[model samples]
Target: MDANSPTSQYASLAAHCASAFALPVARALPEQPAAVTAPWCLTVLAADIETAQLEQLAAFVSADQWRPVALDILAARADCKVVRIQLEGDIAFAAARLALLELGQSLGVELVLQAGETQRAPKLACFDMDSTLIQAEVIDELAKIAGVGDQVAEITLSAMRGELDFQQSFRKRMGLLKGFTEASLAEIAPRIPIMPGAQRLLLALRALGCKSAILSGGFTYFANYLRDNHLAVDFVHANQLEFDGGALTGNVIDPIVDGARKALLLQEIAKALDLSLDQVIAVGDGANDLPMLSLGALGIAFHAKPKVRAEAPQAIDGFGLDAALYLFGLNDRAIAALLDERT
Candidate 1:
């Protein structure tokens, strides 16, 4: 970081922030724009970037033969910033996506690459509960009390990674909770760790006029709790766990919220909200999430398994959930303003 650079203030704010420079976009120039009227957009979200590195990336875009027609500093905070690059050319999505991933890994940042469409700030935000809304898989917590923690965790991991069928794995795991008590389950629900940035993200989305929903393969107990606690959450749907005599019956009621069901619920909610799928943003972290993930205009695999990450149209493991704001075209300043308005 040069002392004279415009970003010197941010450089000082981020201790040990590296000055990153990429080789190039690393793709054969696709071709000149055939009949396109709009420029494609690349939005970079990062903790820090020095002036010279930003210039290098702009040059790299030019090196790929794409004309960088415009650049915008969406945000300029010391701790976080977003840069938007508007380019004119026919760059292949695959090549640009690869470049985006490599850039993120090399520079410790997150990137969103897509056509520069004026997508309405997502009017509907759908989220998966376990590992998405919160850090823990609720069932695994229950299994721990049931003394089957290891067994349930193994199945959960396999099921999440798509190596095992969700319903089959789900039933098998529930069976291990036959003797788990309602009291025990309730005790753990309050302690479930909300994913970092979840509360702020939900509040910010609501402020942006988006209706939030939780479509979970997990049980209703915890899901409903999340909805109740977060005033911004509009609705929630999850598998119903049947209990009797103040204890678990080890069965999920009919109509399990599997992958297919999640997708259905998303459509149902969109219809209820009078919004189309194009105005939606679906986010999750597992194989079961893929079905619903594909439905949204901006479907994201959030800090997901490798298979899920590869399958989703977009993946964001580079930052916390609030980073979704950048993909929605909200700069850090805009996000802060929106969130501050909420409080």
Candidate 2:
């Protein structure tokens, strides 16, 4: 192949080495032209590839299969060759470079190549209102009036950590609020500080025609508060606390909204909106948020507890709730354009 030809360009790219890379080769000479679904095809070779090496190539954490390939020295299998790749985008040159690096670092291995790209879109944004979109937990604050703030907060922490089940844990905490008044909600609702950049993020999604919801394990009182304020959510599914004679009735309404319920609500809302599971993004910071997170297309563990972060595919450790927008590829100018539309 001439150096100026497409095959030559891909061959040159594949020859360049790094820890892991993908190279694109010219399409085969055939009677019919097939569609190039992925921008680049990668030839991966790693007799020994480590987790860190995979992360450096993929820009995300590596799962376990590639570890041994990075660590051991093995003969390149011609007949039983396999490809273990963590794809980024479909840039042929980029993939080629990544694949070359992997091959260069390994002693013996050669795998086939195919090019592809992933298009991720969130149709539904499911959120936990308390401590996720907003900074406060409604029931925890109310516990202070009943003089069980410390105990209630401890249980809240435990429940959020996945140590306790949501309904059971919430009931244990709510029992401490037997004499609390609904009036406290009025005071606390206004004081609930919205998470930084939360409003802008949601507004951006709404502007983009994305459906959103608050599938909270919290109560309807504050869920309504979010709706009445700036959330602009399409649906809200939450627990309802029963009251009597202007005082706490010490009993929750029937069908408590718990973890399993949260998952069901996410599916229900997605179905109602005619969106598939791959179009839903579930964001939360607690253990109870796991079910819905597991079910969505991209489950963001936003400033979540350590356990939640470990299990979630994506996490926002450096930024605010608004950072979640980055996973959607939105930027400052895009957000400003969105903000203007909402007005």
Candidate 3:
């Protein structure tokens, strides 16, 4: 590719982003420009997305006055591949995301973007426990053992959907699990289902020297089990269910790890580690996870509720949690290399 080719420019431009602003006097390119530059990047993930389809969106971008530079291949698999497009002009946030929505859906791809400055892999990542790291909501499982699964699951759904107050809903759900035996609760722990791609994702993150924490609205009982037995997490913070006489008391210890508290803990950890909030990544799938999600530099709604998907900065419902690697610009080879290096 020619040095002046629009397709030949992103790596250097991304490095000099501090000084590279918009081009003045209305710059225009030839019929076929090579690689290019941009401060904002759009990462495309799908089984296969044709260059022509992407170019159509690029043409639309050009028509709308934003410059589309180069399309770089990041990672690939037998089924899906990840690619990125470098953009130059500063388009509105929503517009940049929507640029590929229609075309992306038709092409069967998921597109996510972030400011180039913050695109480096996060040093700290916070995850919500239930329905995130694990497939089961602990309370619902306990409620079922107590013969009140329907009642608890209802409130759980309501709270996750952002309809009911989380603390109140949590207490209600716990109350229903009051009669559950200690033995039953213990049994639930070992059988808890881990989310797909969870262990690999954590191991990869650990290899990258990223600290992972579980900030759960669920009970500490379940969260601790996940931390100790399954994932490579460094910290765990969650609500505690009190037990008396070998039965759940239906009461929790103070300091419920609701949304607000999750946000506070995220900051506290960042400060203690001497890292900026911009270096943190938060991932969750419910309404109560929103606070911490909003705090991190990049918040991902991982197979989340509709409300969360709509509100969060970025969301990926098309793949497992491992798809997050693509968001950090880690292609298949990079992820494989990181996994190989993980202990």
Q: Superposing all C-alpha atoms, what RMSD in Å does each candidate have to the true structure?
A: 6.7, 12.5, 7.8
**Model 2 residue 88 distance off true place after TM-score fit, in angstroms:** 4.6
lDDT by residue for model 1 (230-337), tens: 536888899888889999888768788899999999999999889888888899998889999889888889999777876777788856788787667665556767
In model 1, where do residues sit more than 4 Å from their true spots?
Answer: 1-38, 51-56, 157-163, 341-343
Q: Where does candidate 2 stray beyond 4 Å?
A: 1-121, 154-164, 341-343
lDDT ranking of the models: 1, 3, 2
What TM-score number comes out for model 1? 0.83
Model 2 per-residue lDDT tens digits across residues 26-116: 2222222123243332333333333344335433213311212111111112221112332344234334434443443353433323222
Comparison by lDDT, 2 against 3, better one: 3
Error of 2 at 277 (Å): 0.6
Least accurate 10 contiguous residues by lDDT in model 2: 67-76
Q: What do the candidate models score in CA lDDT, each in turn?
A: 0.74, 0.60, 0.74
